[model samples]
Target: MAAMKSTLSDAARQVAANALQNTLVDLLGLSLIGKQIHWNVVGSRFRSVHLQLDELVTEVREAADQVAERAATLGVPPDGCPATIASAIALPVPQADWVRDDEAIEIVTEALHIAATRLRKRIEATENSDPVTQDLLISVTAELEKQHWMFASGHAAHAQ
Candidate 1:
């Protein structure tokens, strides 16, 4: 008879590491994009738009922290260094041309949508391996989806 191989599910660890790396990369892009817009925001809506953009940067930074900590908890080195993240992240190159609320929303929504999709895949990978990790991904993904939905809804309404 063939001997059965022993196995332990560490899929969660893999998911955590992947997510942490991706999050930091996206966060770096998010920070630059948000700050660029914040500094150059113009028009009569400056105050309101500035405040909202600041909140978004704050939220993305928080998510980065959570993902990094989770990676450490899983005994993996957190994958981030400013230069490396900048180079590795697959975000749109920071553009300083968009000066409208809808423009800002479009850029941010696209980036966050990418991040959210990545997280959803991570959630699936970890779901059967670890409920804790799956729950974490789901929670984070939900927040990203909320932002995406807001952006998408605005576009839809405007188009109609």
Candidate 2:
């Protein structure tokens, strides 16, 4: 499909593109982290936590695609390079080694929270200049919030 021509001014498109790029980076990082946790999580809750991390990984990857495509529509090249993502991501990198279920839960929850918080700012950043971008970010933010809640709830239950 042909990319949609953006109606936003160059300056506005630049701003929106930056916001989208930032979101894309964070989402990519989150997806990788989710996968890392999925692959390495151990403990009595292994099966459930592993499954949940897979779901989170899928969701974040989808969101990253949407954000990157949106940026492309605005004539911005979306950067998904490892170095770019590593440097631009708002969340801390979890340990590379195997992690227990509780540690995995904390790591993923923190990353999701960071993504959601940044996405909220992006939503506001695009509001006046690019309503469509704002709406897209709003949708992403909503999903991240829901995912965060799901993880948080599970973490609470795991703690008890």
Candidate 3:
């Protein structure tokens, strides 16, 4: 896509770009984590969790692309290198090599919570300087919230 000239001041553009970059990193991290859980989850609920995680991964991938492309459109180079993403993302890595369905839900839900919180902050950061970016973040945040609800709902019946 062609880079578009932004009406916001350079400083504002820089701020928005920074938020976008962070969002991209978080999305990438979440996607990888989801895939990892999808592959390693083994239990009675294995098939269901695996399929749900795959869907989450796909959603995260699309969100990451949207965030990165927005940064590029603003003329800011998005840093999507694996090292950069690993270092920049705030979500914790899962400690266990293999996880049961309950554990996987906890891990994935925590990551989604973190991502959703950060995305909301990014949306706020971009609101005044760039409504378009803020809107994009809002959409992303909404989707993340829905995914979190879905994941949480799966374990709700078992919760004491």
Q: Write the per-residue lDDT of candidate 3 for residues 74-159, one digit (tens) a residue.
A: 88888899899877878967765888889999999989999999888888889898999999999999999999999999888657
Tell me model 2's lDDT, rounded to 2 decimals: 0.88
Residue 80 CA displacement from its true place in model 3, Å: 0.9
Q: Assess every candidate by TM-score.
A: 0.78, 0.94, 0.94
Ranking by lDDT: 3, 2, 1
The alpha-carbon deviation from the true structure for residue 105 of candidate 3, after best TM-score superposition, in angstroms, is 0.4
Per residue, candidate 1 scores C-alpha lDDT tens digits across 111-144 of 7788788778878777776667577778778877
In terms of lDDT, model 1 sits at 0.69
Model 2 clash tally, residue pairs:
0
Candidate 2 lDDT, tens digit per residue, 75-94? 78899999998777779777
Per-structure clash totals for the candidates: 0, 0, 0
lDDT of each: 0.69, 0.88, 0.89
> How well does candidate 2 match the true structure in TM-score terms?
0.94
Stretches off by above 4 angstroms in model 3 are: 1-5
